[model samples]
Target: MPTILVADDDANIRELVCLFLRNDGFDTVEAKDGKEALTVYTSVHIDLVVLDIMMPNMDGWALCKELRKRSPDLPLLMLTARGETWEKVKGFELGTDDYLTKPFDPLELTVRVKSLLKRYKMAFTQTIQFGSITLDRKTYKVLCGANSLVLPLKEFELLYKLSGTPGQVFTREQLIDQIWGMDYAGDDRTIDVHIKRLRERFVGTPDFCIETVRGLGYRLEIMS
Candidate 1:
């Protein structure tokens, strides 16, 4: 069973969330503050975390950053009273996989937790296959039917990241930080350029396509 760390200042909310998660077949660890949450996280093998933004000792933003630094792929879901667009954007920038405003339904939270876990599992695999295409992260190769093609390092990493979590929209900033590193002092449009190249290269292929999500960033969609 996957272990979930529920960190919130409110004991009632923590208990309620953990109760629902436990009822749905997940083991949970609870912490009333971000400091305790971090300590619990380091000591326990937590598969995912549900955290609130405002807390004593340490806030969710700081905790999120610390956790992301420690475990790049660890799934984080933020629960907060603030539903502002900037808050959501900041959460994503800090490496949160999902966000839910306060007063949310427990059932909705459970569903989101399962979705995040599923996405995390898919991303943890070294190789991912959709239709006729196979992305081998170990060798950095794209195997489509009889052909084995190599992409540029950046392009390959971008594709691998997107394909790892199909339908998950990743902002250009997230892509740059994850793929190009935080110190990458370049224009974000580089992501667009790389996406274009990947699309042109795989245009005739029916396996998947990289989609631009208008105001958002991009997501990989597998062709049916």
Candidate 2:
């Protein structure tokens, strides 16, 4: 599960969001204000952060800047009642990845979280590792602790391509072109079948797992 830090002053809002996000299969950490948010952020390997604009002690705009400086590639989402165009432009200028107006739909928030993860992955690159499992992009082998597992041609290439940017959601069409040739006569379910076998061989990795983005595609999420 992807871990998100949710910062808001309103007790009810923070609790409600954590409840809904947990129900959506995401792991969430809560903060009551900007300072607390920063503290939580520095202490954890947070995948995404949600900040409310009008909080006490540092507000979302300032917090956004702080977080951006910490990790230029970190994904930040701002939530506030201010829906004005100027406020949004200001948030974007400060490096927020997405902004949502208050009284926002819980479902929409979840969707935004996934979208930000996808966007951040596109903009960044790093070795994908979780626990003792490492997806070596160059060799197309999963290094599990002291051992290595070599995958089939399709599975190796597919996992290697995804490892190029972990957390990136790849649609079936894109995967087909990357693995089997675009001219290959196959359905999307063919991708699913291969994914099933890949997961079976990917052993000893409870923290690293492939996630099916509902109504979209697949993304490999490595939890810290």
TM-score of each: 0.89, 0.56
Local distance difference test, per candidate? 0.91, 0.80
Clashes of each: 0, 0
User: What global local distance difference test value does model 2 have?
Assistant: 0.80
Model 1 lDDT per residue over 74-126, tens place:
98999989788778778877888888999999999999999888888989999
Regions of model 2 farther than 4 Å from truth: 125-224
Residue by residue across 113-222, what tens digits does model 2's lDDT show? 88888756754543556678776666667788898888788887777666545666666766786679769886868889988887888755676678886554677776
Model 1, 131: alpha-carbon shift in Å? Answer: 2.2
Clashing pairs in 1: none
